[model samples]
Target: MFSRAVRPAVRAGSLAVSRTAPSNAANFATLREIEGRLKSIKNIEKITNTMKVIASTRLTRAQKAMEDSRSYGQTSNTVFENAETKAPEDKKTLLVVASSDKGLCGGIHSGLSKATRRILQEHPEADIVVLGEKAKAQLSRTHPNAIVLSFANVCKDIPNFNDAQAIADQIALLPNEYGSIKIIYNKFLNAQSYEAGTVEAYSEEAITQSPNLSAFETDEETLANLREYALANNLYWALAEGHACEISARRNAMEASITWGFGPEPD
Candidate 1:
């Protein structure tokens, strides 16, 4: 019943419809892929949420410790400032750098390492004292000849004053050949940022140059005792700061791992 012209028109219509079908199918496939990715992200959000909660809980204790030590550390430094005016002078410098033994804490290790490297580059002749295995390992590679002392496996649980004492003793006895001591560690500003600061141990020159010592009333014996106390307190503060940084780093790393579809579940 159909004419020959109608037959050719029907064939052309069928060909056009076939050409459009693949494109629509491809679009649908792409949509499905995107949906899968979104679901994965949601799963990650849940894990990160849990981790954030846990980190927040631990952060309270760490923050309290940090706050309590700040005053003690400052007072100790003031005492050192008073006594350093009489200490003997030398020419060599010793640098004490602290870091965490573990990784996966967002760039905590790398950041500390980078900062330490910059310090080393600035003072190429200084001797290095590294705390934590990670620091020892990294500095070993980047500065093979600089490291004079290293302490590893120091963070088992809560870092203690005893650990600080041990570290302080080592630093205090740096052959008495070194002119000055510099302690470098991450200063925790907040959850998201840290500053690497190098604090020089109070020295005779520092005391003479300081303009704020007139307020203190102390004699030589008391001044010497204060200097020793200040050194220990500084070491304690460094340990506490390092511990806080480790927690922050671990939390950040765990969250990142969750985001990247790692860990227990994958959506």
Candidate 2:
């Protein structure tokens, strides 16, 4: 219906558009892929930001509680430290390890595991009550027989008096009747620095038998109550502090993981 000259021009224009269509579709596909990845990165950024906020809030509250607990624990145990309470000879020992049940933090759980192994090497006969599954798994591999009790679903939040009390009650029910209880936890030195530490919760007998016990005021029935209370108090402090360490370590590790979103590492 048109002249030959115009027909040739129209056909050439149609061929050019046909040749470019695939490239346009390919470009759109590449753009969509890039967009999907960008969205993923953005989502991760949001998650990272949210976690940072949560960690900061938790860290603040944990620090406040830890300060109060630390003061209380120090004050409560000052007497025992002053008296130099020593466990009796040849009695069973209970190691109450304070660690979290989860992962994602750098060396936080492993540090406690290594420390626990070292302690086991030193006191091969001592029994242990692991507070978290992370430590339980590590210790179970080599020292399964030594693990008497293990509690999970711990360290998801800041520890309170009730948590400590419950753990202590279970420990008290154990038939071993340990001469002394030692709590090993990761001590939060700073945001980036942590190390394993131990706090002793002496038995009622040790408390009464302390060399300088007579120096304190007279109390017949209060010694048992004090022993129980101090055990809970120490556990509360250790759990709270160790929880803070985990949160701090997780926040730091998460922050570092952001770089991985860029791409694969260079060879």
Candidate 3:
């Protein structure tokens, strides 16, 4: 009878051990999960921090270039501004959206698309020429037929005058004559804000139709050349400023991501 009682006690001990074993295993599994999640969050944080640094570096150069281009572009368009030039109401409109190939810069491209759509609503017959893949992709979905031209990698780096000239050359080759060409781009307002705006390039006809055109004496050939030059200048300016806006927006976005817990929260 003592041997039988000792056997029952051993069985009860084994049952108690079995019950505690699962609790220990569960705790270990939870710890492992938390460790993995924390590791992932840390990696994301490092990546975002690196990207923010890069954007900050580029933003400085881009803003400087934007300022320089602003002066150049303003000088080129001075004549038009002085003459109070306007586009003919009866002619077709062409919108050249200034955007970049790369994304991840907040709503930079989307803002352009929205602005384009707004303009399209007012003028359904307007044609579109997209400067970057991002805006092209968005516009293709909504206004495929209206897209007359598209360029990729146009603003991959800091834009130069040559890049703008090449684009203007292509635009000139298009058979359909546009009465007005508007370059739509994100105008940088501040470090954290941007908005879509337009730089207008009037056609030869529109230029001639200006009320003050009679005051400025110019030959037809020279006028044509001036128009081409002005177009390229405006394009370069738009590209530069848009690029700056993108960089600033990207930096802000990365910072916000880390601060606002874009990734999984760490324990």
**Candidate of highest TM-score:** 3
TM-score of each: 0.69, 0.82, 0.87
Error of 1 at 132 (Å): 0.3
TM-score for candidate 3 = 0.87
Residues 22-102 of candidate 2 have per-residue lDDT tens digits of 544643358889999889889977786677677767787877777777876787779898888998877878898898776
lDDT of 1 by residue, 120-156 (tens): 7867888888888877887788898889888888665
Model 1, residue 68: C-alpha shift (Å): 1.3
The TM-score measured for candidate 2 stands at: 0.82
| Model 3 root-mean-square deviation | 4.4
- Name the lDDT value of residue 117 in candidate 1: 83
Poorest lDDT segment (10 consecutive residues) of candidate 1: 81-90
Deviation (Å) of 89 in candidate 1:
8.4
- After best superposition, candidate 2 residue 1: deviation in angstroms? 36
Against the unseen true structure, what C-alpha lDDT does each candidate score?
A: 0.70, 0.83, 0.89
